[model samples]
Target: MNRPTLTRVLVANRGEIACRVMRTAKAMGMTTVAVHSTIDRDARHSREADIRVDLGGSKASESYLNIDKIIAAALSSGAQAIHPGYGFLSENAGFARAIEQAGLIFLGPPASAIDAMGSKSAAKALMETAGVPLVPGYHGEAQDADTFRAAAERIGYPVLLKATAGGGGKGMKVVERESELAEALASAQREAQSSFGDSRMLVEKYVLQPRHVEIQVFADQHGHCLYLNERDCSIQRRHQKVVEEAPAPGLTPALRQAMGESAVRAAQAIGYVGAGTVEFLLDARGEFFFMEMNTRLQVEHPVTEAITGLDLVAWQIRVAQGEPLPLTQAQVPLNGHAIEVRLYAEDPDNEFLPATGTLALYRESNPGPGKRVDSGVAEGDSVSPFYDPMLGKLIAWGEDREQARLRLLSMLDEFAVGGVRTNLAFLRRIIGHPAFAKAELDTGFIPRHQAELLPPPTPLPEAFWQQAAQAWVRTQPDQGLWTSGNGLRLGLPAETVLHLRSRDQHQVVHALAATDGQGIRQGETVYVRWEGEVHGVSLFDPIAQADASHTTQGGLTAPMNGSIVRVMVQAGQSVEAGTALVVLEAMKMEHSIRAPAAGVVKGVTCQEGEMVSEGSVLVEME
Candidate 1:
């Protein structure tokens, strides 16, 4: 049924996903309104939309996720619908119900579907009742230690403790042994309460070497539903997916058919309407178990879009407009390989801690034959400490997986970022890994190669020499280095030394080594000769504008701007290298900063009460 057209849509989200939805909404002839927080006033999404609404504060509670505020924005802007582009209130069933109550269309699954999947335990029960395969675990309300211990014992060791109310790798822990059960349980509860406002949890058998796969399904009010194939999201850290790909490598046709069927069945079971994702954990033996269902568009939906050549956002709007699915399941064609890597504003070397700062420069790689970038920031956008660390997603499609991976790697290497810390190298490393190339991955992929994935700081490549040389030449008044070498240096001999910090260790780079004609010894110090001024080049992390710093006696420096969420120790407290010093929340995820060296906490500069910028002193150890 082709119904009345929606004239306008309000994006009930900020950042990249908001920009993503706005692009499709505008292209589909719908005027777009962006709802943003004070921190996001200058956000790219706000600028891209036809109208903008300031939701007020930087914190999520004050803005993006505020259901009432979002509805008001939509109604005020004359938007006929609201598109929650993942996260925040996307899966909040109450939000959907509210939208319907307000007589506005929600471009997502029905409130019933959201309610069915909003609670993990409830969803599991629903899936189990529907005869869908599920991981064996306890989903009861027993929270006592003895009861939990008994349940764990029953489920056997290596069980997973997961928060029942939320997704994203938050509030989840893998217990490898009985000794860690209690701590894991408590931690899971704490994280759950903090993230989802619920402390309830459930346990399930941990599938070692399991693959994370999900199928995208679409449904309409006309009783038409279809599956859009599958996406492999096994490349993960902390149980949260970091990379996603369509047409999973090594996925046999038989397994794909089985997974897709299961996904459809799951959707049909919930009377799912609009777009939803059925996630599954595929074990080594090709056995798949339903993990949970995401009742909204996924962060990695672009891969599915690339392969099927279908615009999911547009489809979501059309379906909301009462249009039946245009294609049947049989017509949902899957073509080409598409991979997406999430570029985050986090320090990979520092336990992938969330980072916050201005994106001094944000550059998007041009979508060539098989590349696309969905971003919410432009140059000079500040990555606020209160939001998720993700800057944007870089997606590439190719005739095959290797071509896509290769293209993505090249794009990652060429991409440049100059503010705060980010994981460009980390992403490049994952794509470059042989196991990744061969699709030999599981949940344990990062752990098996943890050392390599987060490699210690090494010397910068000669390419740095070229960039610095060019920069220095440009700064010079006369001589262009590419043309003449004489103008490259000042007449007076000078030396500059920079102390670079990487992985919390300091290394001094001599910018210029002094020389006396041939060589000179000042007392016992010998000055050696070098060509031009020493560039002091070191490993340059994309988002980290400057990793070099001067060391002080009080505390280790905060590498980027952030707020201290938790201070684990006080002055004179003994600590170890990996001891949690303070927890910092930046770019929307929590970062547990550990001590860089084993020593006594001599001083602390960052307080739980104040905001600290990059390079601000945090805690000093003696």
Candidate 2:
């Protein structure tokens, strides 16, 4: 079969994936055309493309996901192929068929393969017919509650209720016992209807302590297929994968061969082509069951790329153009361990609610030895509420899993983001935990470490002194010294006092200045010293409340605002030091204010429904 060379390709998506795909296309000497929604006109991906086409609107439905607009953009831009990067139209069979019919190439699997594995229920049936080890469940069409309830009861307690049309941990719930069945069903149905336009559900026995492992498969038009090892996506929160690693730990050579064979069978069963993923749930006892197959490239594809040194996007494009598999199954070698952690614009301490804000300061740490940051937005981009909360993916590679874990943790600590709350610090702690280091991973890891993960906010003591020193240093004149209107303010004082407020805690520090020297203040109490300059403070601990007032020694009022999301304790509620006292929802996520020390809830100042702006007082604890 003769394949036409793609001179120009339109990337039908936005953000990091678009940027990632464009890199390979550009490297292959193909002109990259970027299609952007109105709001993303100045986006990083759009700017990187050879030419830009506007998709007319910001919302995904009107722009990125709109079939007609995307096709029109490609046609008008004189593009030969379209690359739908992962999310919008990436797994949509109809979209792929339409693209092909429109005299343009679709850089992914054939439409038939997408349709085969697109629907969860339909895919499950097909996998079962293909002799795959499926989790015991009811894939039958019994929508009535009585029928479903009876099936769930038969399957035993702690069964999983899932929406048939879509899977994302959304429209899904685990009923621990029979009494919670009705509520779980209703909630699942509601979410399913809202998410996928289908309330049809399926019930399966929930796999406890299950490890989420998925195999990456690549296929060509010439009936050739290969598996690119496996990724363990067990570290999850709210059923969403927070971190993923390739060559899943604890997999013996025997088990690796078995799972890889099963994955290949899954892809071959549906005549899958291009890039696809076969997911499985591995139990504590080493039993594995087919979960589902993602017809599109997954978000964690970087980990696979890191380990294999094979660019999956480039392969997808090649296979779509009727190219044969470059390497056979036996020859494809997996090297090095790789891990990817999703960086989200979220506050982990506050239920991991999504956050939206400008990228006040987006800086990737220098990767020492083995670290890679794949980010979408730059310093000035706005993380709008229009789509997924994920900002980017951080990938690390090492000769071994432990080295990879340590490298990832170090890189996370070096990440500094300001202007909006992020889960960077939380991710750092998670990667360093013993359970994760040992690869004793499971889907329940986050929930299990929920308490330890959110112990308390520890404000850096140096930060307070640093800020105070800066304020004091700025008070002196560049030439000599100037008085602050009062006669008592000209020369450097023998001693200076500053009061700093951090959430519910107040502290006072005293510093003595040197004559005409570095503007650092040295004090006797706690052997405090300040270095005149400020290092990066954006990654500092979050300001718990916007309205906290501290009686600083300098007597300056803190700028604080925002309504409280939760008051952890009532008036006179006794609490220990570091106990969460209140929650504030600001900039699209939640922020918890904890007690600085053991104290009673002296006063309750804010109500639940109250609208707070910048500096509203929330609670007072003694």
- The predictions' CA RMSDs to the true structure, in order, are 6.9, 8.3
All candidates' lDDT scores? 0.78, 0.74
lDDT digits (tens) for residues 1-622 of candidate 1? 6656899999898889999998988787889999889978888898999999999986777787678898998899899888988877888889999999998988888888888887788899998898888998988877787787888899898898888776888788889888888866776776676566678898998878888989998989987777898999998998888999998888998888888888888888888898889999988888889988889899999999999999999889988888888998889888989999998887776677777767655556655788898887887787777777788999999899999999998788656665556787788888898889988878789889888787675664444433433333333334333344344356743444444333333344444422212222222211221221112223334335455644576467776666676777899889877887876655444556678778899877777747777777788788
Candidate 1: RMSD to truth: 6.9
lDDT of 2 by residue, 1-622 (tens): 8478788999998889999999999988899999888878898899999999998875566788789988898899899899988765786788899999999999887788887787777889998887888998887777888877898888888898887765556677879988888866876776565444568898998877899999999888888888999999999876778899999998887888898888888888778888888899998778899988888888899999888889888898788778898998888878889999998887665566666667756767796567888888887687765556678889999999988888887777667665556787778768888878878799989878877666665555765655544444444434132223333545756455555433244556564442332222222111111221112221112255345635433111112333454555788789887675666544222345667678777777677746554444566655
In model 1, the runs with Cα more than 4 Å from the true position are 1-3, 143-147, 178-183, 459-467, 474-560, 563-582, 593-622
Using TM-score as the measure, the top candidate is: 1
Q: Tell how far residue 153 is off in model 1, in angstroms.
A: 2.9
